[model samples]
Target chain A: MSGEQTAAIESDIEAAIREDHPALITYITAGDPSLEDTKEYVEALDCGGSDLIELGLPFSEPIAEGPTIQAAINRALDAGTTPARFFELVDELETDAPLLVMTYYNMILQYGSEPDVRPFVERAADAGLSGIIVPDLPAEEADPLRDACDEHGLDLVFIVAPTTAGERLDRIMSQVSGFAYVQARLGTTGARADVSNATHDSLTRLSAYDVPKAVGFGVSEGDHAAEIIEAGADGVIVGSALVDLIAEHGTGDAPAADALESKARELKRGARRGGEQRNGHEQGREEAPEPEQP
Target chain B: MSETESNPPAEDEPNRERTFGDYGGQYVPEALMPALQELEDAYQRYVLDNEDGFMDEFRERMRDFGGRPTPLQRADRLSKRYDREIYLKREDLVHGGAHKLNNALGQVLLAKYMGKERIIAETGAGQHGTATAMAATHLDMPCEIYMGRTDVNRQRPNVYRMRMNGAEVNPVDAGSGTLKEAINETMRDWATTVERTHYVIGSIVGPHPFPRLVRDFQSVISAEARDQIQEQAGRLPDSVVACAGGGSNTMGTFHEFVPDSSVDLYAVEAGGSSLEIDQDEGLAPNSATLSTGTDGVLHGAMTKLLQTTDGQIVESHSVSAGLDYAGVGPELSHLVDTGRVTPASVDDDAALNAFHRLSNLEGIIPALESSHALGFLEEAHEELGDLVVVNVSGRGDKDLETVLEETENRDLDAAPDVEVFDT
Candidate 1:
């Protein structure tokens, strides 16, 4: 839990955002089929061009997840995924990309014999986790966890929904470390056939915040990644789409790891293509606009 | 807590405390924060401040449509049997046959004032759904209810009652298909439809404004009972007992009397078959959260919960669907922790026995949820002072099938003989 270790996630995300292309963030439920499979999947995602990976510590009541991830969580829980076991998996993982633990607030609150956030945050930092994402912990109730994360030097990422606005949005942005998770839609996390219009509006709304913005929710394919990135997101997050692959192929299946790797590669390429197109359009507009000025 | 101080400030003061001690807070997704904020504003203006004659209309509607001020009857047979003056707060007499309408009606009316176009809610035993449906129909608002598929099948009559009152019952089939899942599904709906829809949480649970909001509406139960007992019995009762599930009725019956230190408040939970939790299976054999639960966050609030050592919420059990919840209201958790309210529990057999005893002795059939309180009285009446007031939270009409099926499986000492009649 050293200060240098705690700053890993924010620094890694910042470096990734500074690259020529938008950062690609991939998510998979830890211990979905088995912890061994999760380790392999994380390595695959990292090698396939993921800038950061989020490992879900399965909670029994994941109100923030949709059917695909919920089924994966139930599978992980049935296979006996616990907070202690999740940390052990994180400790064992070897990946090029920094890792974060996405879980419900209760798991952190009840990590020890009593309800305290420090014990869990300290353990997360020790396990080499760069940041933590709690969908249920809004800015209004995030002070204790934020303080704990600050003390532990781990980033505390907050999700900003389309409905989020005004003073609340300002408060959340001020507290957020690493990248602010910008929900691409108004609902819970799931993969959709197309990117939502709300994604563009939300990115515009969050333009004033200094934190890097990563758009998630309803992001399914390479095109979705490209669309979100083109609309001005620093990163693109895909979860349900990757989890759907695990659900389709049992973790024991040899192709499961390969499927995740291929999907990650495609999403990363789309993000790069989007960055090139946006830069080209901006340069074209700058060169052609002077004569039309009134 | 004083009535005025209990109302939170309208503005979002960063330092304002939204919790009851260490419990309660808006532990919900960012999408629902605006809805909670809007609801808080509406609650403060219309509910606490009574803006636009809101409280006047609400009280008038309760009297005209909901049969408010349900009588406080002195149970003659129960008084003699317990050797004390037993008073029953007859909440079962409220319209829709449960104390649920007190909160449901108030929330629905408040939604109308806030200009919400639709209403949504979740129910376990269907009492809350039925009450909300009735209120919505009475108020001319569209309504929908999320009910577990398991409960939808078992509580058919209440399901039909809800449908008859014009509510679409969506059966949630996820994770055990029970109250917990229904609540999650309802929350999911609210998260997506926050602007146009208002989710009427049936109990005094959930985030900051809801627990306080629901409590204010349901407090009418104690508001009347406290005055009724003083006039009827010439003094306040020594002990007040109510069943605890999500604790709407318990909080409703206890809110007015909490400051009266002389009077004792008891929240009787359903002990089911046992209190021992099977850690390996992630199951708790009872719904006795107040009695044996640890502090954990659930359903948007930091409350007492039945959870495993690894922080996984365990599946809870109770023969009575209404009492089958793993979490209790955060306010109740604070009350129990501070020792303002005593926590007790009764087994399923005892609750079943009390259901029959009240029917046979006093000609009043009690809901299985309410039977838990009656069972507690039967177990510890001698310790209660000369006067005791018990809240009959609902009628037993919805529990006839469940009681009959459960009674046939066990030999309840007080159960009336029911030999199968020749078909």
Candidate 2:
């Protein structure tokens, strides 16, 4: 808590990996129902054992998002969510887990003067944001913003897709400070009943690097989370499912928090299942080696 | 016209960077980077420099199916009226009734070579949609086109034509229901279905390779016009003029002649209401990105875009649905910066006037988009040399309803006043 923001995020992820626990990252579009609801949702996620919280700065067009997240963004925009409002909401968050802002490149590019993305990273640092993820800004086009983020003590996370080439993956991994986001599928963000082999393959490829690799997109259930963790993902990132839960059960409903709490716990249990099985082979005769910190 | 004519072309600037100044880069999501790279590699290997006869096959298809080498006809009647040499590059004679076929045919063929099973496209004015449909049918590929609800309603004939040619048209009602929103939807579709699908972008726009590739395919218009004009008119035209929307036709007609110092390139934008109107007043004049726009990214590429100070893309207004756009192609933006391509705008009123003039005087109906280029003739008459080739990008068959309505409105305005008295 006393160190720099990005260093704190890196250490936090490293600590989780050392503990042999998959970091549970929860994402919700800020100001979906309202900013107030979002604040409560953040607290709920933190209490529910989320290792990291991703606040979606709603854009007019969320192209990478599917129906659920897109509708959430639309609702947030209708509620008059702006980048200023997003930062303001983030300023109000009092949570144990690190907070990151996920947004499109244009929103950040538009925040300051033309062609200068530094102001955004400066503002994120000033606002106490641990990291920033631009899903649309690939590593190749992320140099300017990445430099600014590095200057402002903000971790710049890049996305690695199933379709990403080996060389491009290496390039992305080289630049990432926080965990690298590995898309769980070839399509837009949505929840599916079963994860595809492509997801496992992407995670396996991403595992070669030293970066913490978290898998998202179509990660809806505990089994889905477990499948990814079993395949060697360091973290599980869930978005649509939580948004869907929020939609089904209003923030006012006790069941909503309960559902989130249970879901988080179940996914955590699923995450531990892989390590537990590994430990079972030793049968208490020998202890497993502790994961190294970054 | 004054600035473009006086300013010289920057022959050295094209080699600067991957971007056109600060415009034209891959501004899309990371999910699309691999796809764009794959496309670039495929384009270089299979289409541009492959040992296989892919380029030949593409040319053969362009010749047999697309009817390439569309004529460059000298406009004798228009020349006499304007008292200037005016010629037309007949893209209208292309199989799909516009230059859109050039891009569609090449992309669909590329998609075929890449082993993609389906083709997806976004279209405005239905010209690109109809052309994509034609390519899809000819290649026996599944095709889906996203069209704005307003465009679908207005360009009903082209919509019908798209369906008749075997393509599904998804009507997008988002964001003023125009070309911009349609592109957003198509990008979403491509993101989800990139494995089996290829996005056949209709213009010299979008992210890299798209603008470059589409311009390369459509450049045949100017290439042919360059030679055809030399053979017929016995010299290069003084200026090359084409309507600019996403700027494929204009770039196609202008790209080959970029190094030609003497040849002036003029891009006529759809002036909609008027480029002179205050953009903040909620009355946006479409296709004036070059005139009243600042450089910003939209639809994927960094380009001159009609946007707010906060970078929110402003909706463009145009009577010509084909020319209704908030952003121009990135290369056009560079050309505009280097004073290579001169940006000219024609309001809806004048474009309609030109549409009527061409129909009546030359017995040829031009699309409202093409009418913008014809509309520029009034301004360029003084600057014209012995030869000026205007890219007649498309025929006006799809615009009959809009033309007929405007004509009726004009006729009603001209009707004699009648007074009625009751006893």
Whose lDDT is greatest here? 1
* Residue lDDT tens for model 2, B1-423: 111211232345443245777789888877788788879877777756753778898788999998887888888899998887889988988997889999898899899999899999999888999999999999999999999998888888888998998899999977677888888889989987887899999887888878878887887887788777777767778888999988999999988788878899999998887675453443466669887788767778888888666555667888888888888899999889988888988987778888888877777788889999998896566776767999999999888767666655553221122222112
lDDT computed for candidate 2: 0.80
Candidate No. with top DockQ: 1
Interface RMSD of 1: 0.7
Docking class of 1: medium
Identify the candidate with maximal TM-score.
1
| Model 1 error, position B313 (Å) | 0.9
Q: Could you tell me the lDDT of residue B173 within candidate 2?
A: 77
In order, candidate lDDTs are 0.90, 0.80
Q: Write the per-residue lDDT of candidate 2 for residues A1-294, one digit (tens) a residue.
A: 112434444444445434546778889899887888888778888888788889999776567888889888877877777788888888878887888999887778888876578887888888888889887787778889878976877778788887886788777777777778888887788878998898878877766677788889999888888778878888889999998987788645334667777777777677667445534544465775653322
Q: Model 1: per-residue lDDT, tens digit, B1-423?
A: 112212222423322357988899999999999999899899879987899999999999999999998999999999999999999999999998999999999999999999999999999999999999999999999999999999998889989999999999999988999999999999988988888999999999998799999988999998888888888888888999999999999999999888788999999999999999999999998999999999999999999999998788998999889999999999999999999999999999999999999999999999999999999999999988999999999999999988988888899999977657315
